[model samples]
Target chain A: MKILLIEDELELATSVLDFLKSEHYLVELASDFPTAYEKAIVYEYDCLIVDINLPGGGTGLDVIRALKKLHPESAVIIISARNGVEDRIVGLDLGADDYLTKPFHLSELNARLKALLRRRHFGGSSDIVFHEIKIKPAERNVYIKENLLDLTPKEYDLLLYFLSNQHHVLRRESIAEHLLGDDADQMDDFNFIYSHIKNLRKKLIDRGCLDYVKAVYGIGYKFTDKK
Target chain B: MKLLHQTQRLFFRGVLPVFIAAGIVSFFTLRWVFDHETDEKLLGVQAEIESYVRINDTLPTFFQTVFDRWYAEPMPTGSMTNLKAYTFSDTMLFNKFENEIEPFRQLRFPVKMRGQIWMVSALTSTVEHHDLVLILAVLLVTMFGLLLLVMLWVNRIVSRQVWQPFFETLEKMRRFRLADHALLTLPPSSVEEIQELNTTLENLAYQVRQDYQTVKKFTENASHELQTPLAIIQGKVEILLQNDTLSETQAQQINIIGQSTRRMVRLNQSLLLLSKIENNQFLERKPVALKPLLEKRLVWLEDFIAEKKLELETILVEISLEINPFLAETLMTNLLTNAVKHNIQGGFLRVILNENYLIVENSAALPEASVKDLTARFARGNPHSEGVGLGLAMVVEICEQQGFGLEISFEQGIWRVQLRFRK
Candidate 1:
């Protein structure tokens, strides 16, 4: 899938670009408003990630407006530091699909992006299957070979998040943020994440499924079909 | 006191003494004029009798009957040396109607008739003591009545008209609120002092509102600007944590960095919320039921409470409050989180909701000093706890903005927070 990221902050843009690239998606960057406007008008993409406050004296809402007019089929998500409720309403009203506040976890962003794409391009399918593992997104139920695996709500969410970014290394902080959002900030320690991951892995391995969950040495965990 | 009543008080205070003094002085002056006129008439009568004696060379027969007394006696040799001597004295005379003695004013003088030295005495009609007192009393009463009428006019009509502008300005001030953004428009006045006061107050209110807006804007801009960079730092740390070649110790250190970055994000968000509340941004209000909201929050916090192995008891009465819905939610979340976060291991947490108030109590470690400090920003009872310390401060702010009463106290090793809703 092709994704266009319009952001003025080079460092944040680079981090986002690298993360998305590691997921094996084709990503392009537009560092200013005019460039973003030019590129958005010139080509069509599967998804558009736009920041509200763009450089060159224009807003991302204007970009979304222009893009919707030119390519009405494109999906748009607004990422902004201005987390005012009014801004969120305005963005959604302007035909954008989602709004994400800044200082958010990249993993959470990735999850939301996948959910949006799944709804837009995949006919709103709720079932996700990977070899022996099957997930019904609507019911939040997971199964291996037609046998149900009981999982806590948090564990199920964590597993789905891991499956979306199969090979990318998932940091503990990112996992915690995906699970708890801002509430994770109140936790004095990140040790609870380790237990949740361990339980999820055990539940899968006991269900006659290959263990795709891998520990990235001193960092965190990863799920991949690769050896 | 009300401004109008205060003015009346001062007016009466000043006018009452002057009225009494003037009445007394005028009463005495009238009495002196009456006595002086009576003396002049008696002297005229004596002079006329002496001239008649000189012109006709015989006493007038009508003089003795008309006057109280017309007596001519041989003057003593020493008294005759001075041709004329006049004297006035008060004397008593019998009244035939009432058959009682009455006071009189008598005049005595020396006269010469046909070169014969003679003494003449005359008494005017008796001037009753009671009549003199009654006249003075009437004069005093009349003066007092006039003064009362003037005072009443000034207090009720004149002063009210004069102070109308001042009272109007006072009323406007009483209704003014900084959050309403309504500028004070004082009524136009011709009085210089009232106009000056209104101008000064208007300028002061304008300056205060300007300063408040500037500060609010600064807080919003600063928070907005800091968010992106903080996001960048947090993202970089997350990326670094994914490196497989990093040592365990280095990974631990990076994990600490990530945790602190998350804390900073929470702190920044809390600060932004506080500023928004101070700016009165949450103006929408509705009646919210407390029982359901508290129950929902408790379910959300079940994990935290279980983690601490704390016993939880909730006694929620059916009560509804008028408040901003979002603020009410925030208040409940913060209070419940504080109760669970600060409680001791294996301790008890109690929540009680009633018609007038909501109380949250929890078993805690012995307080260092006082619970009053807990309501202030960054005042944490346990320094090692992970809370950002803005929770209770936000609760206090919401309470003040909503006109709810808040009190925090610690007793018997339990910390209790009570919020009283205005009826």
Candidate 2:
């Protein structure tokens, strides 16, 4: 996927760019508003991740508007430093697909971006396929070698999240947020992630599938097939 | 009493005594002067009769008007020495002309005639000062009543007109609120005191609004600034975690840092939400079926309940409330989650929801220390729990802002939280 990143903060931009590049996405960074505007108008990208607070005589909202007019097919996600709902409402009203407040997990952002793309681009054949496991997102079904694998809703979501960002360490916090949304706040819920991961691993192993879910040392989990 | 009515009542009370006292003094003064003149006229009538008898050598019986009568009685043989010269008395006389008894002031005087003194008595029946005094009293009272009525009428008109601007200012002040961002407005007035009051209030309102804006801006900018730095730290740490070159100690250190960073983020977001709720920024309302909402929320708590082996009993009726969905979710999520989080293993959790209130009662594990001030900030039920401790605080804030009643208490190791929708 080709994504245009509009950000003025060099440090945060570097981390995001490195993360996205490692995820094998063709990413371009526009550090200022004028350059972002020109690039957004000139080229067609599959997705545009625009920071709402940009420098150089313009805001990222204007760029999203102009890019959306030129290429209505391009997906847009707004990242704002403001936690206020007014700006989020305005951005959403102006045709942005999603809004992420600053200090967000890159993994969370990637999950949202993948979900938006899947809903937008793959509405007809919304299937996520791996080596042995295949998922029909529209039907909320998963199959292994023409045999249905009975999975709970949370387990299915966990497997899909791992598939979306394979080989990257997914923190327990990010997983909880993805699964629970606003209900993730105000308490520690590490036990739920642990129990769910254990059950999912057991179910898959019993079905003679390779263990793709790996737990990092004192960190979180990663999906990798390498020995 | 209304201000105008109270003033009128005080003035009415003050004016009555002076009016009564003035009428009494005037009546007495008129009566005293009238009596002196009547006495002089009676003596003069007696002198004329004596002069006529002496000059003509007989009693003068020429003529008499209808209201006047006179008589000459011969003095007794030697009784003239006992009666000095003159005597006067008021008598009731029966007049054949008028049938009713008439009051007469009479005087008796001695007239020497042929060595025997002729005693003469003159009576005047036209003494009408009693009726005159009564007429004067009635006139005085009538004038006082007219004066009081005119004063009351004038006072009513004056107060209604003059206090108009003050009432208008009061109404405008009552309607002024910071949430609407409307400036205070006042109607102009010609009265100096009222005009000054309006200006002062307008100035005060302007100052209050300016201060409010400043506080609001500061909160937004502060949150923004803090969030950016925290984002940078969080992003850098997230990127650093992707590497596979860290020692065990380093990994542990990073894990600690990450945990603290996430906790900070939650704290920041919670504080911001609290401020927004207090500012009355969330005013959108929609009718919601609370039974389904709570049922769904309870499903999210299934994992936690199963983990602690809690027994949750929920009795939700079909109750509809007009509220912002975000607030309802927050309040319920906090209450439901806290109940489960703090409960004992195999303990009972009972949630009863009716039209009036929502009650959540749960048994606790090792809750010997009384959890006082549960809704205060950072006052956790468990001192070592991983919560940021603003959960119940946020619930309390939303309840207060939305005019809901909240009662939280811990008794005999059972914690109960009651949220009342109706007062």
Candidate 3:
């Protein structure tokens, strides 16, 4: 998949680029409005991550409008520091697929991009299979080798999120944000995340599946099919 | 007092004494003039009678016909010495037409007729004391009525026209809100005092609005600048945590950094939200069914409540509130979060909703904290607690902007928050 990231902040853009590259997606960068607008019109991208506040005079909304006219099939996600509901509504109404507030985790952004891509490219498929584990997105049900696995709603969501971004290192903060959204900011510790991960790991092991979930040292969990 | 009414009262206070004094002075002055004229007429009649007696050497028969009453008595011979005194006195006489005794002003004079000293007394006309009083009373009443009517007419015109601009400025000031960005406009006035007042008020309002915008801009820029760096720090920490050579202690220390970064981000977001709310950015409003919304939020919060092991009870009535839906949801979420966060393990939570209010009560683990401190920014019952402390503060801001009443109290080891909505 090819994606374009339009952001003025260099550190945030680098982190997002690194995370998406590790997921094996080809990504392009545009730091200002004019370049972003030019690139968006010239080349076709499967997805576009546009920041509303560009370094130049123009805004990302303008770019989204132009890009939508140029490539109607491209999916756009708006990343803005402005958390106002009106801005979100305006972005979504202007044909943007999703809106994420600033200071967000890279993993959460990846998860959103994955969901958007799945819907856009896969024609809204419900079933996703990775080796022995299978998931029904519509029913939120998971099974292993024809045996249904019992998982809480949150656990089911976490499993699906990890499966979508397999082999990518997921930070605890990103996992927390993906699960709790804005509420994760209030948590002072990651003990609950640890517990949830423990239970999910034990459940998968009990179902005779390989240990696909791995801890990347001090960082967080990663789901992979690689040996 | 209202400005118009106050002015009217002052005018009455000043005019009332002058009106009474004028009435008294005019009454007495008129009475004295009328009395002097009557005396002059009586003297003229005396002169004509005396002239006739001197010409004919006898009293005229016209004296008895012209006067209402008359008497002439001669003093004894050799006892009267220069007996030619003239005097006037009031007397009572019987009136045959009205069959009553009426007052009269009488004049007496001594006239010489054929070398005899004759005492002559004549009644000129009836002059009742009450007649003078009645005339004075009628004249004073008519003057008073005219004065009152003129004063009322002037007051109405002055209040409606002369003070119209003042009143308009007053109304504008009443409706002025700093967030609305609509400056007060006062019509130009011919009056110097009102003009000065309007100019000063306009300057004051302009200064205030400028200051408010400055503060709002500063907050927005500060939040935006701070957020990017916070994100960078958090990102670096996450990257560092991925190193396999790191010790457990290193990981724990890095986790602390991550946790504090999260807290800072939340604080920044809350402050930004407060500034936005103060700036009146959330203006769109719709009628929201609050009960269903609350129920939905509760379902989302079920995990949080379950983790706390708090027993939940809800009495949600169908209440419709007119407010911005985003703010309404945030308010409810904050209230529920506070209730669960502050409650003790295995505690009880009751959410009661009625037509006018929503009440959330929870059993507290520690001693009851001050309601003022609890609702303030960064306030927490337990210092070690993970709460960012902006929940209640945001709730309070939302309540104030939305014209809702928020009351917090702690009693019997229970923390209760009540939100009263306008009917």
Candidate 4:
């Protein structure tokens, strides 16, 4: 997938650039609004990760407005340090698909980008199939072979999150946030993460599926098909 | 005490005594002057009798009437020497006609009549003087009473006028809210002291607001500035996590750093939210269905609640409140999360929503004997919990900004928090 990253902060921009590039996407960097605007109008891209604050004579919102007019079907995501209500509403109302606040996990960002691309390209008709595990986005169902995986709503979401970002380490904090937006404020943070994941893993194993989950020591759970 | 009452107290303790004392002194001075004049009149009578008796011997014809009584008596052995000068005495005399003793002013004087020293005693009825003094006393008391009343009334009016601006300032201060946008209203005052008071008060209010804004802006800027670096750190750690050749210790260190960075982000966001609430930034209002919002929030805590097997009870009433929908959802979610998070194992968590209140009650493992400040910042029952320790503090800020009431109580291992919705 082709993606455009418009950010002013050099270090953050580099980290995002490297992360997205490592994800095997054609990621282009535009550190200023003018370059972002020029490249966005001149090139074709699958997704645009725009920061609300940008230097060079224009804000990220302006880039979104200019490029969105040219390509209304483009997947646009707004990342801002200004996470106020009005900022989020303004970005979303301007046809941005999602609004991610600053200091976000790049894994979460990648999942959002992939989801946005999938929806934009196939119109959500694509059934995400991973070997024996299958997730139908339209029907909101997961299947292991012929039998439906009887998973709770939380388990279902956790599985989908794991499937999308397979082989990537997912932090407990990020997982909690992804599951519960602001209510991810858990008393025992890892307990809720552990409870849901344990149940999900048990359900998957009982469905006669090989365990594709690995605990990376003290880091977080990882989904990999290796051994 | 009120200013008026304080001044009136001054009149009671200080001015009123001086008034009473001056009245007494004046009454005594008037009596002395009257008595002196009467004594002089008696001396003239004595002299007149002496001259008459000397010029035409054989006791001058004198009629004894009730109004005037006089007598002549030869000097008794020692009495003549005792009468050196004219003497006056306040004595009682009996009158045959009246058949009652009447007060009299008597004067005795020694006189040489026809070459003989005689004691001439003269008496006059003192009923008139007594009547005059009684009337004077009555009049004086009436005048002083009227003066005191008038003084009190005048003092009341004068104090009310003198202190009018002061009380006005007090009332304006009482009604002033820091969250309001308007400056403290200090109306013009003519009194120099009052005007000075107003100036000082206005300055204090302005300074307080300025400091408040400075701190608020500082908090917001700090939070915003930290966001980029925090994001960079987390991003770098995530990138490092994908390294295949990294050792176990290196991976753990990277993961720990990423977790701490994520925590810092949550902390920053929470602080930003707190300052925003204090700033009254959420102003949009709408009628929100609260039950559904709470039900939706509770679903997020469902896993933990079930993991501990804590019984959950939610009794909600169909009530609507006019508030910012975002704030409303946040308030409900925070309250629910706090209740579920702190509940003990096998303990019950109950949520009851009334028309104007929402109460969350849960059983605690270690019940505090006294009331604790759960709403204070970073006040967590468990320090090691994953919470940012700002949940209840944010709830308190939202409630305070929105004019809602918050009450937290712990009784018999039951920790209860009630949010009283403003009517």
| Candidate 2 vs 4: which has more DockQ | 4
- Model 2 CA deviation exceeding 4 Å by range: A84-86, A118-127, B1-217, B365-372
Chain B of candidate 1 versus the native chain B: what TM-score? Answer: 0.83
Task: RMSD for all candidates, in order, please.
Answer: 5.1, 7.1, 6.1, 2.2
Largest TM-score belongs to which candidate?
A: 4
iRMSD, model 3, in Å = 2.8
Error of 1 at A227 (Å): 15
lDDT of 2 by residue, B280-389 (tens): 77889888788887888789888888888888798889998988888888888888888888888889889999999999999976553455566788777677788888
DockQ of each: 0.41, 0.53, 0.30, 0.73
Candidates 1 and 4 compared by DockQ, better number: 4
Q: Candidate 3, residue B176: CA error in Å?
A: 2.8
Candidate 2 residue pairs that clash:
none
Instruction: List, residue by residue over B257-308, the lDDT tens digit for candidate 1.
Output: 8778778887888888888888888989999999999998887666667767
Give model 4's TM-score versus the native structure.
0.95
What's the i-RMS of each model? 2.6, 1.6, 2.8, 2.0
Model 4 scores a C-alpha lDDT of: 0.84
lDDT of 1 by residue, A58-170 (tens): 89999999999999889999999986888999999989999888987777778888878888886666678899999877677898999999999988989899988777677
Query: What tens-digit string does per-residue lDDT give for candidate 2 at A1-227?
Result: 99999988888888899889888889999999999999999998989998999889999899988988899989999998876678899899889999988888888888788888888798736888888888888888888876799999999888888888888778778788777765576568667888888998998888888999988877788888864
Model 2 chain B: worst 10 consecutive residues (lDDT sum): B365-374
The 0-to-1 C-alpha lDDT of every candidate, in the order given, reads 0.83, 0.83, 0.83, 0.84
